[model samples]
Target: MPQPSVLIAGAGPSGLVLALVLLQNGVHVRIIDKERTHRIGSRAAGVMARTLELYAQLGVLNDILAVTSPFGPMASYDFGELVPKSKTAFLFEHQEPTPDIPYPNTEAVNQTKHEGVLREHLAKLGCTVELAAELRGFEQSAEGVMAKIMHTAEDGRQNEETATFEWLVGTDGAHSVVRKQLGLSFLGETRTEHVVGLGDIVVEEGLGMDVAHMWFINGKMILVRPDDVNNKMFSFLYRTSSAEKPLTREDFVEEFYRITGRRDVKFGEATWLSKYTPNIRMVDTMRKGRVFVAGDAAHCHTPTGGQGLNSSVQDAANLGWKLALVYKKLAPASLLDTYAEERMRVIAHMLGLTTALGDTNRANMGKKDFKMQHPDAMRMLGVNYRGSSIVCEEPGAAEGVDDPYMGGVGGRVQAAYRAPDASELVPAGKQDKTTRLFEMFSASRHTVLVFGGDAGTRAPVVKALEHFPATGVIHAVLVLGQGNATPSDAPSFATVLEDRAGHAYKGYDVDTGELAVVVVRPDGVVGVVASDAEGLERYFKKILIAA
Candidate 1:
């Protein structure tokens, strides 16, 4: 086979997303997994806000929303006595949406269904998952990777082929062959005593599907939440006693009845059942030469904060655009290094947070006043890449990071933060309706927004950007005041837009008559916040190559 631009091993969420995003950008990718069948289970059930935004860009968010609902309110009982409302899970109320942040709440969805939605969209994009194809081994050179993949036939025959690709990404799970072949260190801890038994069961009697129910008794915590499926279906996760033997579906049901002390809540049969030891492990590095590791291949933690799948999806989102740039030769290979640097810190922080939450779980096991609390940080909107070498911040600013670019360069804003979403952008020649900054971003290329500047200040910036040969990989947009018209001398290559409601300027932190330039990366991060044409040129010169 001819070498693809990229080869992806493991058709899980991370690998599938990486393939779809790359394919959307016109990059050829081959994605394969060792599993013979699609997954079936309720694993990793919380989808954070950041992942939702990325899903919107991928065009699958609405479909996912159609199949999911807000996490039902959590109800806890102590020996049949109901706990107070404050003690329920989700410690914080859902954050009200602001103009700058469209998605402020998490959606409750399982891993299996989420992957199914992603695969459906990938098929629509003309790509299919090659199942029963395992990555046996590989060797990497400066030019690319030669991988040996074993394909299993229906007749029980196996055929191995050696394929070459410019890049190889391992989105394989924790026990990843790619990570093992690369000899990367997955350093962390695992505790056999901390075991969680989970299952999907049909409720014989209707337990109000509007709320998640839980019981704490005799050193155990049992939780039940509604799934998207109808017919009073619920997914359960419970802690097994450290001294208890291996758990079975009958054990879970018996314990559930014993704790609640109620025969009214009954289970007919379990659709899925499994037991797992809680483990927290992460790769020291995400990339080595031309091969890379993402998702569980890179990090795995207890699902306390539901960060597993969300973090993995973000990892693919972060790496997808950078890989495409390198494949097109529009950016240098060093850009890939930022993938490790940026993701490592976030994963480390996530590990620490989830570990602490696991400790909370153990502590609250037998307590009468157990509170199932969720933290605000779990939403994952605060992650940023301010300290990265590629992120250029203006001088005399807050130094490391800024809160909102709407505050301007001098105002408080992080240079490498996720660019805030804004609305009321009128695309040129369209007057009937307005658009959004996210709609313009779309993750295909870098987006340059020139905010509230006169032609004198904006003209030179546009001209200088046109002079750069990297226009194919960088998109330029001019956001003028509601009354100001596009200057006749404006760069013909640039897209002229009107911020009629002033949300763009306000959200991006530029005052009327004051010139500001915000450069958004393909992954929708604010790359640089500059004040002039010279600053814009300087930012691009560091990341882009001549066309």
Candidate 2:
């Protein structure tokens, strides 16, 4: 077999996602993890809305939703109280699904099963994560990267090998060897004042599985939530000022009974136990030469808002398409620079949001204020890349908008925001069945939407798209306004559709009879919002290589 184009240093969600994206785009990838076996604990459990949308594009959302549970309410209790005081507080409130936003509520699934679903998808694609294969070191030049990989056998045998690939991505986590080799500054502070103990235990009985239980006694706190449907397994977090020594299952059991005053709630067994020290850190940049770092290796913060895994997955999604385009020679290497430019801004904003949530949790130690509801920003639907170096915007466009986390949806549709979904679109000359805009999106290609333009107005825009590769790379869709018939002169290369309910026009913020062009990138971000053919050509010029 030929050498892989990319070597991913971690097999966690971020690495798996990046590998899947590359393979979907017809790029070769080899993903590796240092562990001897797949992980088994409920590390990160919350899956946000934006992540679910991305999974839908990857064709794994159904499997994920099939096994996961919706984010439920939390039952709060005071010191030594067997009965709960309140049961209305929620980590994330459920929102009704709108035409534009399909998965409006957060879902809960442990990291083990979540990774299992992703690996299953990868297996169907003829790729698997190489266990026990660790990236020890790597050196990158202008052309490719030379990596040293350490492989450990099951019986304690170890061997080192050298390999070469076009690019190396580090998703090896916070203590990443790849990041340290690159000498990037991980600038941040470690919170030493508090330490958290996390683990999974089997509860015999007496706790309901529908709600997460939280207990506050004197100045101590412990939160436990059901992990499986059987209500036998649960995940808990105990926060304290200090733990001079490592904690055992006995210690956790003793503390649980002491805090909750519920000795009747017997404990069976402990599945896993670990300590967590809150560290707020991020790298200045994500790339250097042919090497790049993403996910936890790039940034890590408190897991208060369930943004760590979601942000990591988003980072992979943002970089995967650009890397594929560059690898295939369809786009210039400069296109890869925008990956860092776009994601770093979003990561900075996310770190602040999660840190604030952590501070609030710390401040409300003994109070009855544990009824926390995550802000809408946690959904991440409004994160935008307005004013990006590669995005093109028409005059009077909302460029450099300050609302990074809560703009674009139900607001003016801008150039670099998340593209909203539109339904009730009928193919030209057919009204039997309708399709949604999201159904036409794919991770391997770009979607160009021409909204409500006359034949003469659309001819030039359609002609501009001919400059790029047409086979599985760039797809053009012509969306006509309501009550407008498809013109005979419509371009044969484009898919012509009629908006029967005007959802396409309304969701995109385009007026009827308006001549506008919107380019959705492979990652479902609005890359360009243009008024005419000149704007379209100018935008693609920055992305595609010159003929």
Q: Pick the candidate with the highest TM-score.
A: 2
lDDT of 2 at 239: 83
Residue 192's lDDT in candidate 2: 71
Instruction: Report clashes for each candidate as comma-separated counts.
Output: 5, 0
Candidate 2 worst ten-residue window by lDDT: 393-402
Evaluated at residue 59, the lDDT of candidate 2 is 84
Residue pairs that clash (backbone atoms under 3 angstroms), model 2: none
Candidate 2 Cα lDDT to native: 0.86
lDDT of 1: 0.80
Task: Report how far off residue 499 is in candidate 1 (Å).
Answer: 2.1
Per-residue lDDT over 419-520 for candidate 2, one digit per residue giving the tens place of the 0 to 100 score: 888888998867798988887777898888888768877788877887777667888888888888778666554678888888889988898777988888
What TM-score should be assigned to candidate 1? 0.92
Q: What is the TM-score of each candidate against the true structure?
A: 0.92, 0.96
